[model samples]
Target: MSAEIVVLLVVFVGLLILNVPVAVAIGVSALAMIATLGHVPTAFLMAERMSNGINSFPLLAIPFFVLSGVLMGQGGMARRLMDFAAAMVGRLPGGLAYVNTLSCMLFGAVSGSAAAAVSSIGGFMIPQMKEKGYSKEFAVALTATSATTGLLIPPSNIMIVYAVVSGGVSVAGLFMAGVVPGMLIGFLLMVASAVLMRVGGHSKAGVAQVPRFWPAFFGALPSLLLIFIVLGGILGGVFSPTEASAIAVAYAVVLGGFFYRQLGWADVPKILLIAAKTTSVVMLLIGASQAMSWVLTYENIPQMVSEAMLTLSANPLMVFLLINVLLLLVGTFMDMTPAVLIFTPIFLPVVVELGMHPVHFGIMMIANLCIGLCTPPVGTCLFVGCSVGGTTIARTTLPAIPFFLAMLVGLLLVTYVPWFSMALPGWLNLF
Candidate 1:
């Protein structure tokens, strides 16, 4: 690496260690690196880059999806979805645990935000699980880990961001690619929950109020329809992902306001304000990340990284393992959005050179980052989950071990077996 690259990397990492906000850290680091170059004006170019970063047509999907998720959470859609999941899995050995896992999968899919899933689904489920005699630590751990499935599922903001960073590879293709792997992770989590439940003797807590399939399914149908409408429209070619997000917003409004009667005119301003604030944070992060990415690219960092990775391993599988390990560590400290922006450019070409598909790599990258959302120091979902469950991170982290392993296993399958992520998209000709 050049002196400039070294300075940028050091400043960024040092700021992170000092607990600086990620967007500010990235923005200042990029600016500092540019200053080191010593010929051009940093302010104007950085301003233009930040503006251009959030300038993509596809990026409009972020705010719409954010609004839709907020509406769905406030409209009582999450509870109904949980009811449906409970009904389907209510009689299993670890019934409520199954419900928790599946509910996160469903809610996360709809919300497209893992933190939202943790808070929305966990806000209800964690209390209910505790009422049903589930261990508090287990409840918090399960909720935090399970909520991560949202990032791997469709209508995911992370996936859209990945698409933008990866040179606009099909958003639909990445969404399709995520379907099986997302479920795989959910299923693994379910199995782990079931086994742990049986071992801990908590299987009977949910039997007293077994949920019926037809009733729960009917109750959740409208909520389920949101998924079908947003995802179906995309898969059926009715709209692009960005267009689908608008439809999502419209549908969420109708569902919350008219159909469900859970929302009212009084709620509009609050929801808009929340959405606007969220959009600003995400867009600024993207802009800062874009500027940092440009600096790194300008330094030929990706080329150097790729060449170094090749030196570490000639075998494709070994190369993948090394990359996965590095990414997992990265995820532990970095949030998914910035990590995706920063690393995708660096690692993508390495994998592409190894004959992996971009869509598959995109999905793999997401799956790995989802784990980070459930980890400590920077795990957004984990923090929210512990707060909901009324527990400490120290206490909750231990119980989360099995779920983390389950995610890693799912990651391994998605990484090595391309079919896990690529099959549906391939069959549907999304690529």
Candidate 2:
């Protein structure tokens, strides 16, 4: 690596180790590297890059999506989905576990925020699971791991960020691409839960006494309709993903505030405030990551990194494996948004050279990072889940082992089997 690159890494990693905010670490690191190069005024150039970073029309979707998630979560969408899920699978052996998995997947489909799912669904499921004789560790671990499926399902704000940074890869196509892999991850997590139940002697403990399926489904149907509206609107060309996000906010307001009546008019300010805070953090991360990307591109870091990886292995599978391993480690410490923003520019080229579709790579990368959300140190979902469940990370991590393996299995399948990620988008002519 060049001296400038060394300086950037040292500074960035040091700041992160010191618990600095990720956006600040990235901006400072990028600015430091630019200062070393002495080619231009670092502050002026970085300001321009930061301004340009969040200047896209596509990024408007994030705040709306965040708002919608908060609104739905506040209204009782999680409970309705849980009720519907219980009605669907609550009679199976170890049914509460399955209900937890399915409810997270369903909630993820609508809200597209893993942390929101963790907080909403985990709060309810963790206590219920504990009451039903499941361990607190198991409950929190399951909730944290399964919630990541939302990122892979539609209306994902991270996908929007990817589409923006990826320089015109279709948002619709990326949305379509995530469907199967997301479900696959959910299925594998379910399988792992079932296996844990059997091995741990908890198999018959989780049967729930839920209402009839049709009634539960009908009750939850209004909230569920957001999925079809946002995704269908995008796929049908009635609107862009940004417009669909705005529509999702409107629908969430109507469903949560009017139909459900769980979210009172008095709740509006708090929801907006929460959404604004979340959006501000994400937007600042994007802006800083953009400056970092500019520094990387200006220094030809992408080419250098790509060439280095290719030189290590010319075989596509091996190169891809190396990339996955690196990303998995990155995910362990970095939050998903900054990780995606900083790494996409670095690795997209390597995958493209191997003849991988950008849509496929996008899904693969997101799936890989989804696992990170449940890990320690910087796992956002893990922290939220632990908080909701009233457990510690150390307590949850051991129980999370099986689900982690399950997620790894899902990630590998997504990595090797192009069809899993590609088939739906292909069938829809999205590419």
Candidate 3:
């Protein structure tokens, strides 16, 4: 490796080890390497790369989607969706777990964020699960695992990032491709929850014995329409994803403030503030990552990595498996955003070389890394779920094992069965 590369790697690892925020870590490392090597003038390079990173028109979707998710979360749409999911599955064996999974899927469809799913659905369900006789750890495990669906559902900000980073692979096609696999993961998670409930001899007798479904159905209907408006509009070419996000945000605000009468005007500032903070974090990461990617490309790191992988695996299946292993390991330590930004460029050429569709690979990569958001060391959702359940990570992780296995299985299906990710895209003519 070149001296510059060695210095860059050391600075990156040092910043991470010191627990600096990821965006800052990346920026600082890139700046340090550039200064040390004098490869490019620091000020000019930073300005150029940062501008280019956030310059894409598609990136406007990020803040809009984020605001929409926050609006829905604070507006009581998440709770209503949970009620609807509970009504549909609350009578089943381990019904609460199933309800948790289903509710995450529904909320994910609208929010397009796993953290939002956890904060909204999880805050409501974790308490209910405990009240309904589910173990706190199991409840936390279920919520944390289910929250990952956010990355795969429509309006996903991560999908937008992937599209931007991958040099404009179709965002609409990526969105559609995620639907089937996202639902498939939900189904498998629910099944895994059922089996676990049976093994643990948990019963649903503790839940409220509600007989009427109409109220729940009616309450959830409006929120479901938001999904249609955002996703359907995008898929139908009625709106771009950016435009869809704007519409979705408007819908969420109206639903929360007027229709549901849950969120008041007083809540508006807080919602926007939260959304702005989140957007800043994501945008800064994108900016910093762009700088790092610029440096990596200059160093020919992606070419080197791709060539090395091609030498190791001529078979597509082997390449897929190897990538999964690599991602899973990285996911355990890193949050999804930086990981995707860093690795997508490195691995995408490998996928293209193996004759995989970029859309399929994008979906598979997101899903795999989403699993990491629930894993140990830096599992954001796991920590969030535990906070909601008032439990420790150690306590929740044991029950999380089965759910992790279920996610792994789902990942394998999406990775190998390209049809699962491609079918919806094909039908929609999104390719």
Top-lDDT structure, candidate number: 2
**Could you give me the TM-score of model 3 versus the true structure?**
0.97
Q: After superposition, how far is residue 214 of candidate 2 from its true place, in Å?
A: 0.8
Candidate topping TM-score: 2
Q: Which pairs of residues clash in candidate 3, taking residues 3 or more apart in a chain or in different chains?
A: none
Taken over the whole model, the C-alpha lDDT of each candidate is 0.89, 0.92, 0.88
lDDT of 1 at 374: 90
lDDT of 3 at 109: 77
Query: Which of the two candidates, 1 or 3, achieves a greater lDDT against the reference?
Result: 1
Q: Quote the lDDT for 46 in model 3.
A: 84
Clashes of each: 0, 0, 0
Ranking of all predicted structures according to lDDT, beginning with the best and ending with the worst: 2, 1, 3
lDDT of 1: 0.89
User: How well is each residue in 1-431 modelled by candidate 2, as lDDT tens digits?
Assistant: 78999999999999999999999999999999989988799889989999999999999999999999888888888889999999999988899999999999999888888988988998889999999889999999999999999899997999999999988899999988998999999999999999999998889976557779999999889988998898898889899889988999899988988888888878888988999999999999999999999899988999998999999989999989999999999999998999999999999999999989999999999999999999988889999998999889999999999999999999999999999989998999987
* Comparison by TM-score, 1 against 2, better one: 2
TM-score of each: 0.98, 0.98, 0.97
lDDT of 3: 0.88
Error of 2 at 354 (Å): 0.6
- Angstrom error of the Cα, residue 424, model 3: value is 0.6
1-431, model 1: which lDDT tens digit per residue? 58998889899999999999899999999999999998879999899889998899999999999999889888888888888998888787668888888899998998787888888888888888888888889999999999888778787899999999899799999888888999999999988887788888886666447678899999889877877887789989888899999999999898889988999999989989988998988999999999988998988999999999999888999999998999899998999899999999999999999999999999999999999999887899999998988999999988899999999999999999999998999999987
